[model samples]
Target: MSLTWAPALERPDLLAEPVRHALEAMASDGADVAAVEVTEIDPDHADTAVLVEATGWDLRDMANCIVISGARAGEERVCAALVLGHTRADVNKAVRKRLDVRKCSFMPMDEAVGRSGMEYGGITPVGVPSGWPVLVDARVVQREHIVIGSGLRRSKLRLPGALAARLPGAEVVEDLALEPPT
Candidate 1:
Protein backbone atom coordinates (compact mmCIF):
# COMPACT_ATOMS: atom_id res chain seq x y z
CA MET A 1 0.00 0.00 0.00
CA SER A 2 1.38 3.26 -1.11
CA LEU A 3 0.02 5.70 1.41
CA THR A 4 -0.17 9.29 0.35
CA TRP A 5 0.56 11.35 3.42
CA ALA A 6 -0.81 14.84 3.34
CA PRO A 7 0.02 17.53 5.81
CA ALA A 8 -2.23 16.86 8.77
CA LEU A 9 -3.21 20.51 9.04
CA GLU A 10 -4.61 20.34 5.53
CA ARG A 11 -6.91 17.47 6.37
CA PRO A 12 -8.78 18.46 9.50
CA ASP A 13 -11.66 16.24 8.45
CA LEU A 14 -9.42 13.26 9.00
CA LEU A 15 -8.56 14.31 12.54
CA ALA A 16 -10.81 14.28 15.57
CA GLU A 17 -11.62 17.65 17.11
CA PRO A 18 -9.12 17.38 19.91
CA VAL A 19 -6.42 16.13 17.57
CA ARG A 20 -6.98 18.95 15.14
CA HIS A 21 -6.91 21.47 17.93
CA ALA A 22 -3.75 20.00 19.37
CA LEU A 23 -1.92 20.10 16.07
CA GLU A 24 -3.06 23.64 15.48
CA ALA A 25 -1.78 24.64 18.86
CA MET A 26 1.54 23.04 18.16
CA ALA A 27 1.88 24.90 14.91
CA SER A 28 1.20 28.22 16.62
CA ASP A 29 3.96 27.46 19.07
CA GLY A 30 6.43 27.02 16.16
CA ALA A 31 6.51 23.28 16.63
CA ASP A 32 6.55 22.46 12.89
CA VAL A 33 3.28 20.56 12.97
CA ALA A 34 3.58 20.51 9.19
CA ALA A 35 5.97 17.66 9.61
CA VAL A 36 2.99 15.58 10.71
CA GLU A 37 1.20 13.66 8.02
CA VAL A 38 -2.25 12.12 7.93
CA THR A 39 -3.65 9.30 5.87
CA GLU A 40 -7.14 7.83 5.75
CA ILE A 41 -8.00 4.16 5.69
CA ASP A 42 -10.90 1.85 6.31
CA PRO A 43 -11.90 2.08 9.92
CA ASP A 44 -11.68 -1.70 10.16
CA HIS A 45 -7.94 -1.51 9.52
CA ALA A 46 -7.23 1.05 12.21
CA ASP A 47 -5.90 -1.64 14.50
CA THR A 48 -2.19 -2.34 14.55
CA ALA A 49 -2.23 -5.89 13.22
CA VAL A 50 -4.51 -5.17 10.33
CA LEU A 51 -2.79 -1.89 9.61
CA VAL A 52 0.66 -3.42 9.43
CA GLU A 53 -0.53 -6.23 7.18
CA ALA A 54 -2.33 -3.80 4.98
CA THR A 55 0.42 -1.22 4.70
CA GLY A 56 3.47 -3.44 4.84
CA TRP A 57 4.93 -1.17 7.47
CA ASP A 58 7.23 -2.52 10.09
CA LEU A 59 5.52 -3.18 13.41
CA ARG A 60 8.37 -1.41 15.18
CA ASP A 61 7.41 1.81 13.42
CA MET A 62 3.83 1.75 14.66
CA ALA A 63 3.30 3.46 17.96
CA ASN A 64 0.65 2.26 20.40
CA CYS A 65 -0.68 4.60 23.04
CA ILE A 66 -2.12 3.21 26.23
CA VAL A 67 -3.70 5.02 29.16
CA ILE A 68 -2.87 4.00 32.70
CA SER A 69 -4.26 5.15 36.03
CA GLY A 70 -3.05 4.68 39.56
CA ALA A 71 -2.89 6.33 42.93
CA ARG A 72 -0.12 7.24 45.34
CA ALA A 73 -1.16 8.28 48.84
CA GLY A 74 -4.67 8.92 47.56
CA GLU A 75 -3.53 11.28 44.84
CA GLU A 76 -4.63 10.01 41.47
CA ARG A 77 -2.16 9.75 38.60
CA VAL A 78 -2.97 9.07 34.98
CA CYS A 79 -0.59 8.92 32.06
CA ALA A 80 -0.33 7.73 28.50
CA ALA A 81 2.37 5.30 27.50
CA LEU A 82 3.69 5.29 23.94
CA VAL A 83 5.34 2.11 22.84
CA LEU A 84 6.07 0.40 19.59
CA GLY A 85 3.43 -2.06 18.42
CA HIS A 86 5.89 -4.91 18.86
CA THR A 87 6.23 -4.26 22.61
CA ARG A 88 3.96 -3.89 25.60
CA ALA A 89 3.98 -1.21 28.22
CA ASP A 90 5.61 -2.25 31.48
CA VAL A 91 2.68 -1.19 33.59
CA ASN A 92 3.47 -3.43 36.52
CA LYS A 93 7.07 -2.52 37.17
CA ALA A 94 8.31 0.29 34.95
CA VAL A 95 5.09 2.30 34.89
CA ARG A 96 4.33 1.88 38.58
CA LYS A 97 7.86 2.90 39.39
CA ARG A 98 7.62 5.92 37.12
CA LEU A 99 4.34 7.03 38.61
CA ASP A 100 5.59 6.42 42.12
CA VAL A 101 2.44 4.47 42.83
CA ARG A 102 1.85 1.27 44.72
CA LYS A 103 0.03 -0.13 41.71
CA CYS A 104 -0.98 0.96 38.27
CA SER A 105 -3.08 -0.61 35.58
CA PHE A 106 -4.57 0.11 32.23
CA MET A 107 -7.29 2.68 32.52
CA PRO A 108 -10.77 1.46 31.71
CA MET A 109 -11.54 1.81 28.04
CA ASP A 110 -14.63 3.95 28.48
CA GLU A 111 -12.95 6.30 30.93
CA ALA A 112 -9.91 6.61 28.74
CA VAL A 113 -11.99 7.40 25.69
CA GLY A 114 -14.11 9.90 27.59
CA ARG A 115 -11.19 11.63 29.22
CA SER A 116 -9.19 11.81 26.03
CA GLY A 117 -12.11 12.93 23.88
CA MET A 118 -10.77 10.45 21.35
CA GLU A 119 -12.32 7.26 20.14
CA TYR A 120 -11.26 4.01 21.72
CA GLY A 121 -8.53 2.22 19.68
CA GLY A 122 -7.67 5.63 18.30
CA ILE A 123 -6.27 7.59 21.21
CA THR A 124 -2.92 9.35 20.73
CA PRO A 125 -0.75 11.15 23.24
CA VAL A 126 -0.74 14.29 21.13
CA GLY A 127 -3.98 15.52 22.62
CA VAL A 128 -4.14 14.06 26.08
CA PRO A 129 -5.51 16.25 28.86
CA SER A 130 -3.25 18.92 30.23
CA GLY A 131 -1.09 17.75 33.15
CA TRP A 132 -1.25 14.16 31.99
CA PRO A 133 2.21 12.68 31.66
CA VAL A 134 3.01 11.02 28.34
CA LEU A 135 5.71 8.44 28.89
CA VAL A 136 7.22 7.50 25.53
CA ASP A 137 9.33 4.40 25.40
CA ALA A 138 12.88 5.36 24.43
CA ARG A 139 12.81 3.05 21.43
CA VAL A 140 9.91 4.90 19.89
CA VAL A 141 12.00 8.04 19.74
CA GLN A 142 14.68 6.28 17.76
CA ARG A 143 12.47 5.58 14.79
CA GLU A 144 12.71 7.91 11.81
CA HIS A 145 8.92 8.06 11.51
CA ILE A 146 6.27 6.57 13.73
CA VAL A 147 2.68 5.78 12.81
CA ILE A 148 0.12 6.66 15.48
CA GLY A 149 -3.63 7.10 15.76
CA SER A 150 -5.17 10.32 14.50
CA GLY A 151 -7.60 10.44 17.45
CA LEU A 152 -10.14 8.86 15.10
CA ARG A 153 -10.56 5.40 13.67
CA ARG A 154 -10.69 6.51 10.07
CA SER A 155 -7.23 7.98 9.83
CA LYS A 156 -3.67 7.76 11.14
CA LEU A 157 -0.83 10.16 11.75
CA ARG A 158 2.85 9.84 10.92
CA LEU A 159 5.57 12.07 12.25
CA PRO A 160 9.25 12.09 13.11
CA GLY A 161 9.98 10.40 16.41
CA ALA A 162 11.78 13.53 17.59
CA LEU A 163 8.61 15.53 16.94
CA ALA A 164 6.58 13.05 18.99
CA ALA A 165 9.03 13.46 21.84
CA ARG A 166 8.32 17.19 21.70
CA LEU A 167 4.59 16.88 22.29
CA PRO A 168 3.57 18.78 25.36
CA GLY A 169 4.34 16.84 28.53
CA ALA A 170 5.89 13.95 26.64
CA GLU A 171 8.95 12.37 28.23
CA VAL A 172 11.24 9.73 26.84
CA VAL A 173 11.38 6.92 29.39
CA GLU A 174 14.07 4.30 29.16
CA ASP A 175 12.70 0.75 29.01
CA LEU A 176 9.14 1.87 29.45
CA ALA A 177 8.07 -1.12 27.41
CA LEU A 178 9.31 -4.67 26.91
CA GLU A 179 9.14 -7.11 24.05
CA PRO A 180 7.19 -10.24 24.90
CA PRO A 181 9.14 -13.36 25.62
CA THR A 182 9.27 -15.83 22.81
Candidate 2:
Protein backbone atom coordinates (compact mmCIF):
# COMPACT_ATOMS: atom_id res chain seq x y z
CA MET A 1 0.00 0.00 0.00
CA SER A 2 1.37 3.36 -0.96
CA LEU A 3 1.25 5.98 1.80
CA THR A 4 1.32 9.73 1.54
CA TRP A 5 3.78 11.26 3.96
CA ALA A 6 3.54 14.81 5.27
CA PRO A 7 5.71 16.75 7.64
CA ALA A 8 4.34 16.07 11.09
CA LEU A 9 4.60 19.72 12.07
CA GLU A 10 2.42 20.74 9.16
CA ARG A 11 -0.15 18.11 10.01
CA PRO A 12 -0.77 18.76 13.67
CA ASP A 13 -4.21 17.19 13.47
CA LEU A 14 -2.54 13.87 12.95
CA LEU A 15 -0.66 14.10 16.24
CA ALA A 16 -1.84 14.18 19.79
CA GLU A 17 -1.14 17.45 21.65
CA PRO A 18 1.71 16.04 23.69
CA VAL A 19 3.23 14.37 20.66
CA ARG A 20 3.13 17.60 18.68
CA HIS A 21 4.69 19.48 21.55
CA ALA A 22 7.40 16.90 21.93
CA LEU A 23 8.32 17.11 18.26
CA GLU A 24 8.33 20.90 18.40
CA ALA A 25 10.56 20.77 21.45
CA MET A 26 12.96 18.51 19.62
CA ALA A 27 13.10 20.96 16.72
CA SER A 28 13.90 23.80 19.10
CA ASP A 29 16.69 21.67 20.47
CA GLY A 30 18.23 21.70 16.95
CA ALA A 31 16.94 18.32 15.87
CA ASP A 32 16.00 18.24 12.18
CA VAL A 33 12.25 18.63 11.99
CA ALA A 34 12.28 17.51 8.38
CA ALA A 35 13.25 14.06 9.53
CA VAL A 36 9.84 13.49 11.06
CA GLU A 37 6.87 12.59 8.92
CA VAL A 38 3.32 11.46 9.53
CA THR A 39 1.12 9.26 7.44
CA GLU A 40 -2.56 8.48 7.66
CA ILE A 41 -3.60 4.92 8.34
CA ASP A 42 -6.69 2.95 9.19
CA PRO A 43 -7.31 3.09 12.92
CA ASP A 44 -8.16 -0.58 12.76
CA HIS A 45 -4.59 -1.24 11.64
CA ALA A 46 -2.99 0.49 14.58
CA ASP A 47 -1.84 -2.70 16.22
CA THR A 48 1.58 -3.79 15.00
CA ALA A 49 0.55 -7.08 13.44
CA VAL A 50 -2.42 -5.63 11.63
CA LEU A 51 -0.37 -2.66 10.49
CA VAL A 52 2.35 -4.83 9.07
CA GLU A 53 -0.16 -6.85 7.10
CA ALA A 54 -2.07 -3.81 5.91
CA THR A 55 0.89 -1.69 4.90
CA GLY A 56 3.33 -4.36 3.78
CA TRP A 57 6.04 -2.71 5.86
CA ASP A 58 8.74 -4.82 7.35
CA LEU A 59 8.01 -5.67 10.96
CA ARG A 60 11.63 -4.98 11.83
CA ASP A 61 11.18 -1.35 10.87
CA MET A 62 8.37 -0.90 13.32
CA ALA A 63 8.81 -0.12 16.96
CA ASN A 64 6.38 -0.91 19.74
CA CYS A 65 6.24 1.29 22.82
CA ILE A 66 5.01 -0.64 25.81
CA VAL A 67 4.14 1.01 29.10
CA ILE A 68 5.21 -0.75 32.27
CA SER A 69 4.76 0.09 35.93
CA GLY A 70 6.13 -1.08 39.23
CA ALA A 71 6.17 0.04 42.84
CA ARG A 72 8.74 -0.17 45.57
CA ALA A 73 8.66 1.19 49.08
CA GLY A 74 5.45 2.99 48.24
CA GLU A 75 7.00 4.74 45.26
CA GLU A 76 5.47 4.04 41.90
CA ARG A 77 7.63 3.91 38.80
CA VAL A 78 6.41 3.97 35.23
CA CYS A 79 8.41 3.54 32.04
CA ALA A 80 7.90 3.23 28.29
CA ALA A 81 9.97 0.56 26.69
CA LEU A 82 10.54 0.64 22.92
CA VAL A 83 11.25 -2.67 21.27
CA LEU A 84 11.07 -3.99 17.75
CA GLY A 85 7.58 -5.01 16.67
CA HIS A 86 8.74 -8.62 16.52
CA THR A 87 10.18 -8.86 20.03
CA ARG A 88 8.86 -8.53 23.53
CA ALA A 89 10.03 -6.21 26.28
CA ASP A 90 11.83 -8.06 29.02
CA VAL A 91 9.67 -6.51 31.70
CA ASN A 92 10.44 -9.08 34.33
CA LYS A 93 14.17 -8.71 34.03
CA ALA A 94 15.81 -5.87 32.11
CA VAL A 95 12.98 -3.41 32.67
CA ARG A 96 12.62 -4.32 36.34
CA LYS A 97 16.35 -3.98 36.83
CA ARG A 98 16.46 -0.62 35.12
CA LEU A 99 13.51 0.72 37.10
CA ASP A 100 15.25 -0.59 40.20
CA VAL A 101 11.99 -2.18 41.25
CA ARG A 102 11.60 -5.72 42.50
CA LYS A 103 9.03 -6.53 39.82
CA CYS A 104 7.47 -4.84 36.83
CA SER A 105 4.45 -5.57 34.73
CA PHE A 106 2.72 -4.12 31.70
CA MET A 107 0.61 -1.17 32.69
CA PRO A 108 -3.09 -1.66 32.22
CA MET A 109 -4.34 -0.43 28.85
CA ASP A 110 -6.73 2.12 30.33
CA GLU A 111 -4.09 3.55 32.63
CA ALA A 112 -1.46 3.65 29.94
CA VAL A 113 -3.71 5.42 27.47
CA GLY A 114 -5.05 7.83 30.10
CA ARG A 115 -1.65 8.63 31.57
CA SER A 116 0.19 9.09 28.28
CA GLY A 117 -2.53 11.13 26.66
CA MET A 118 -2.15 8.83 23.67
CA GLU A 119 -4.75 6.49 22.36
CA TYR A 120 -4.46 2.84 23.30
CA GLY A 121 -2.57 0.98 20.48
CA GLY A 122 -1.19 4.34 19.43
CA ILE A 123 1.10 5.24 22.31
CA THR A 124 4.63 6.32 21.40
CA PRO A 125 7.66 7.08 23.50
CA VAL A 126 7.80 10.60 22.14
CA GLY A 127 5.04 11.98 24.34
CA VAL A 128 4.87 9.92 27.48
CA PRO A 129 4.88 11.90 30.73
CA SER A 130 8.17 13.75 31.21
CA GLY A 131 8.97 11.85 34.38
CA TRP A 132 8.60 8.44 32.80
CA PRO A 133 11.75 6.91 31.48
CA VAL A 134 11.62 6.07 27.75
CA LEU A 135 13.78 3.03 27.51
CA VAL A 136 14.81 2.08 23.94
CA ASP A 137 16.09 -1.33 23.00
CA ALA A 138 19.56 -1.07 21.46
CA ARG A 139 18.41 -2.91 18.34
CA VAL A 140 15.72 -0.35 17.66
CA VAL A 141 18.24 2.48 17.74
CA GLN A 142 20.29 0.88 15.00
CA ARG A 143 17.57 1.04 12.38
CA GLU A 144 17.89 3.99 10.02
CA HIS A 145 14.16 4.60 9.93
CA ILE A 146 11.54 3.31 12.31
CA VAL A 147 7.77 3.51 12.23
CA ILE A 148 6.07 4.39 15.50
CA GLY A 149 2.73 5.75 16.60
CA SER A 150 1.78 9.42 16.25
CA GLY A 151 -0.26 9.23 19.48
CA LEU A 152 -3.35 8.88 17.34
CA ARG A 153 -4.67 5.66 15.92
CA ARG A 154 -5.54 7.30 12.62
CA SER A 155 -1.96 8.18 11.87
CA LYS A 156 1.60 7.00 12.39
CA LEU A 157 5.01 8.63 12.64
CA ARG A 158 8.23 7.77 10.89
CA LEU A 159 11.55 9.07 12.15
CA PRO A 160 15.17 8.17 12.39
CA GLY A 161 15.95 5.57 15.00
CA ALA A 162 18.63 7.92 16.30
CA LEU A 163 15.93 10.55 16.86
CA ALA A 164 13.91 8.13 18.96
CA ALA A 165 16.90 7.71 21.21
CA ARG A 166 17.00 11.49 21.62
CA LEU A 167 13.47 11.93 22.88
CA PRO A 168 13.20 13.56 26.29
CA GLY A 169 13.96 11.09 29.09
CA ALA A 170 14.98 8.42 26.56
CA GLU A 171 17.65 5.97 27.62
CA VAL A 172 19.20 3.31 25.42
CA VAL A 173 19.04 -0.04 27.12
CA GLU A 174 20.90 -3.03 25.80
CA ASP A 175 19.07 -6.36 25.64
CA LEU A 176 15.86 -4.72 26.72
CA ALA A 177 13.84 -7.08 24.54
CA LEU A 178 13.61 -10.84 24.15
CA GLU A 179 13.32 -12.63 20.82
CA PRO A 180 10.14 -14.60 20.45
CA PRO A 181 10.46 -18.35 20.18
CA THR A 182 10.36 -19.76 16.70
Q: Which candidate number has the best TM-score?
A: 2
List candidate 1 segments past 4 Å from native: none
lDDT (CA) per prediction:
0.93, 0.94
TM-score of each: 0.97, 0.98
Task: Kindly list the per-residue Cα lDDT of model 2 for residues 33-84, writing each as its tens digit.
Answer: 7899999999999999999998899999999999999999999999999999
Clash tally, candidates in order:
0, 0
Candidate 1 structure quality by residue, lDDT tens digits, 84-127: 99999999999999899999999999999999999987999988
- Model 1 scores worst on lDDT over the 10 consecutive residues at 161-170
Clashing pairs in 1: none
Deviation of model 1 at 42, angstroms: 0.7
